[model samples]
Target chain A: MSTIGYKDWNVDLADVGAIYPFQGWEVAMTIVGVIFWLGWHIFQVKRESAHLEKAKQLGDHDKVHQTLERY
Target chain B: MEGNLNALTTVFTEFYYWVTVVFMFLIHVGFCMYEVAASRSRNHMHTLMKNVMIIPLVTVTFFFFGWWIYWAFPMFPFFGGLDLEAGAANLPWAETMGTNSSDRITGVFWAAFLLFSWTAASIVSGAVIERIRSSALWVHAVLIGSVFWIIDAAWGWHYGGWMVKYLGYHDAYASGVIHAIAGGYALGVIMVLGPRIGKFAPDGTPRDIPPHNPWLLAIGIFLIYTGFWGFYAACNVPIIAPEVIGGQITGITWTATNIYLAPTTLSAITFNFLMSLSGGLMAAYLVSKGDAFWTFSGGLAGIITASAGNDLYHPIQAMLVGAVGVVIVYKLHFWVEKKFKLDDAVGAVAVHGYSGVVGLIIAGFLLWGAPSSPFEGYATITPWGQAVGAVIMFFVLGFLPGWGVSKLQSKLGVLRIPEEVELQGLDYAEHHAYEDAKAEIIEADKAHLAARAT
Candidate 1:
């Protein structure tokens, strides 16, 4: 038994198709991947919002002036 | 496995695509250098990181679904159901997608498409640099790189796309399909994202946001030029016998064919690509009055403008088309900047979007009455058809999705960074740590000085 569904190299290559492990789980794999992708956006959006909120409270007028001056 | 001829052809095609993928990598390197050099010192690291990360993010996602989209969505929804027959061989779990000795071409061909995905995403990346939230930009990256760009490729760039069969769409080198769509997508994002604070003056005059390093910009453009050559070769089937193509042409002749199995040559494309590049550079220098950024971009614009007809154009016609297109794009860029307060950090919309649209329309007139495909019963290339194709690429597929999604994100308050973050640099800056460190260091130094005095 092979993860790739072939245990021997003697078979004709033309007869072979789907070579990756677990050949029939594409729809499930794709579903998992899509969830990961969508979940990332949700996670990133939340983290970025929190980061920005903390940054806004850092309103030091003097330091801002100094930074602006350098620019 | 099969006949020797079949094996040889398959192996050759696989090698050809593999080589194209390697060469296309330079395009990303060029964009990274170009963006970092253009951005200010404070923003360089962020700019570099933004583009560098696009490689992995796009790669993983493209492997996941982008490849499947090409095969599966060719006739999806509008014309017929998904082409599951074509898509079956490309599923990630399929043997052809991995280390199957029988099928060598599929992996490399998938990579060629993936490289194009990177290019599509990279184009959008350049236009929103220095100011866009990295998280916001990455979202745009995945959307353009893996999803939207691949869909466009299936619709127009594919050999059996509905656009090709029904609309007589002909973008031999993806002048419209990739460049236009990406540029239009960039334009859509930037319109909502706005410009850097100082990009315009109080009087509504547009100020030049110059690249910090002109030399880097120049080298970056040169690298892009090199990669463009690889892109041209990637669009062709290196060699195919007429019999194998199963077309009407009665000949034993072996020929290189465009994506649609129509004949062209490496030599013909080489002449046109360089000539067009030269034309754009010269015209951009004249038009922008030796502006370094426009001059470099002009070379890219020229190639893109001539790309649609390069498969069949006279080399001189390619040059002329490239030259004329640059002049128009250079003008439109400034006009749009002033007319609308949209801050495209780089001239991406003009370079990719305008140049692509113009090229398609020009190709329509130049290659009028020409067959769009080697397959019989397809609509012939025409001006109206080309215009429709351009709009579909730039507006329908490219701009609308980007705008709609970005608008949705904006409504959710997740599109742009907070005003405070934008004002402060988007780097590591904790409020108390630096000040506390400074105080501690000064106090310690004072004690050391007192000890020394005693």
Candidate 2:
């Protein structure tokens, strides 16, 4: 009934393999990880787009000139 | 000093821990950078020095009595008397504590624990910056670093600890023993120390005291992440035979074991660590609406949240636990700030303390009916046992002593710098000699330039 498939640490080490919990769900976990990775790109793209749009709206010619000169 | 196999294993284990100790030093460097970045320019020197001094102070005091406390206080005053047999070998004057060819392991092992001691004290250091007196904070450092946290380690993290034996207290990576207790200790000190002068509006709304240098802050946290990888490695027994464990484990096979000597794998913790870090980063970005600092800190919070069961968790389970803990800790940080008008300068209480308590209770349910140790006659992991263990860590050992000592310091007028000093800055106030010397040197340079011109 243990999630990791062993109820205790009594097994011989030579016989044990893949001691992580839910040992048989490698594909499912991979799928979840992939989804998470893709989702991050989507979130970052949307957030950055919105941010750049707002920055574009705040265009002040004198301030822009001052920023360039400072740099 | 023995057969080839035994000698090889001993030297290998010694080298492994020595590397982790070197890696863990980066954690302190990160703390210094993070704290200095969080503070204003006026408080920069003070903040850096405050954390930098923790190294020598904690290292010396830990040598004097802290190592002995870990071996001596595992069951003291509760289940049994002092463990003098265990304590004898760890005393400051013990031959093994010094350079000895017969014992290659003690130095590296003591250093590993000593680094953890610095972290516990440094966690407190961040929360009370700018306003606390150096003398006061140093006293708190020695207590938390050399006295309190080690006691909790003996009770929970040690292989034969009483909490592990009776309460099924399973903090595989010190979610409770180090993070929770240090967070609670920070909370206690700040309750009396109060906020930096301008941290609140007169109307009682909270004001954000953003870090002066976000780049340094980011770099600091990144270094901490790097050091944390070594911390995870240090928490395990690199290799051990079943016979060496002498528990219920059978056969001649060797394996890696957790601090409590229960079987685990380095591969398993590695999977959980990266997954949990990712989960935290994503959740923090979403919850904090892409605030850079919180996003970085979220990754750390995520790992702390999952660290309790990282050794045993499915990678996916670790990810979700970390994500959930980040959201809760983020919300709680602001809620406690506004409601109580208490300023935790760097959010230490929520990130470390609250996350630790949350992680411990969650582990109780997730790891229920599981064995807490390989040794026989120990209680199995259960919700009630973990809940009680969390209480002992957060409130009993951590908060009470911190608050009591701070209150005494406050009464003696030694806990905080004066109001005038607070406004002018601790650097200018306490280290006037350096400022005076700088002014004198500049004047002399100006006089030399005038004479040359003439």
Candidate 3:
């Protein structure tokens, strides 16, 4: 069976709409999309904070001053 | 012009393709900038010239015979003989090929395809930069642009193509037809062309060669993304009625169809495109740990990965497909680089070739049993069909011809520049001349100032 519900294009064009797969799962897909978005924020924030913490520990006074001067 | 409605439709269709052609020019501009930025200052002019020259070379060669091959070779040598009757109308000398009152669509349609040829050639140009001879690279450009890629298009991308009829090949936006073939061709060339000097260490560990100008490279990729929007549009027949298509589709409702005469919507592709790009970016950032180059290239890889089924995929599916493809491609790039010791300057093989192959196989499973064409008797989309189509695209048509040609060139001692030239850079002579000119002009200005003082 076609994943998109219709196996062929033998039907009338006026009768057709929304040929994407899993026709009745729009709500479920939206939920998944939301989860992905939320998950990304969580992951990114954690990584960024960890990275910043490491940077703060590693930065020396002279290098920071040199960087400021260069800028 | 015919009736008012017919005339309007014809003019609208012509303008649609014309606009897409104009937008697709940015892809070439982006390629030139990207190639130049990736190369060192000593090679900037040569790198830019190498990519910029692809336009006229592919353009002329495409005009000469490339367009005809698309119509004629859809089933050549295996399924049927050359469709010479259809081919005659597209020949360079044909009346419709030039300015013709009745043929409003020919020029714009030809141009849309010609731009794709340039892109295919430009992709190969990027991988072989800094070392390949201009003459050798141009020869490869013409072959890939006007010869090999078009042949794959005829087999897989054309409406009546055997791959669609028999294998159910469904690359709506040409993940395989354009990207895979070009990437595979680049791989073939680089294997023979060898790595740029200093690209490897004594122990054969690959060294990263940073871009000379990351900012230019970033802007270049962004321009490529913009041009890709036009590319998606160009792959479609903007509007057509069932009667004109003469397929199984009944009723008078006009709709846009992909190159294979399958129904889809511009709105559908739009939703999938953005979602896929986002998915690719997020995944790439995590996978490459926010490396600027891979992250930018990942966005492109994501689009290519989902493009095979973008016309039919749900937006969510597109995103996930793009994300999944990027991770796999990223891993494969490093693994292959280590194992094979082959240098691909821009990761063309991973972003385009591997993503394309993955997209096609994924489309097979996702779109399985879906009609590949609107016409009756066509095979349904299947995983095996897609897998086989990927082989034909990446290996038979793409890699073989590329390797064969490059090997022949290498045997003739003209495939790459001399070792001295490679060390000094391809633009060494030009840079010296430029410096000399600047010195001369400065001395002339000094002399003029002295005379004024006197």
Native contacts present in candidate 2, fraction: 0.49
Better of 1 and 2 by lDDT: 2
| Residue-wise C-alpha lDDT for candidate 1, range A1-71, written one tens digit per residue | 33335332223333544433345766765575456446546755776688689888867899998989999
> For each candidate, how many residue pairs have backbone atoms clashing (under 3 Å)?
3, 0, 0
Q: Give per-model CA RMSD.
A: 16.9, 2.0, 1.2
Score chain A of each prediction against the true chain A by TM-score and list the results.
Answer: 0.86, 0.85, 0.88
Mind sharing the TM-score for model 3? 0.98
- The C-alpha stretches of model 2 lying farther than 4 A from their native spots are A25-55, A59-70, B430-435, B449-454
Residues B315-398 of candidate 2: C-alpha lDDT, one tens digit per residue:
888898898899999999999999988899998998899889999998888888778899888887877988999999999989
Clashing pairs in 3: none
Highest TM-score: give the candidate number. Answer: 3
Ranking by lDDT: 3, 2, 1
Error of 2 at B65 (Å): 1.1
Report the C-alpha displacement of residue A17, candidate 1, in angstroms.
41
Candidate with the larger TM-score of 1 and 3: 3
DockQ of each: 0.01, 0.52, 0.80
Q: Mind giving the per-residue lDDT tens digits that candidate 1 earns over B1-454?
A: 5999888888788888899889999999999999988887667777889899999999999888889999988777799999998988888787788998877788888888888888999999999887777788788889998888788778887878888878878899988989999999999888887788778899888888789999998889888888889999999999987777775444567778788777777887998899889879877876776677898999999999999878877666677789889999999998898899778888999999999999999888877767777667677777898999999889988898888878877888877776676666554354345668899999999999999999
Best by DockQ: 3
Candidate 1 all-Cα RMSD: 16.9
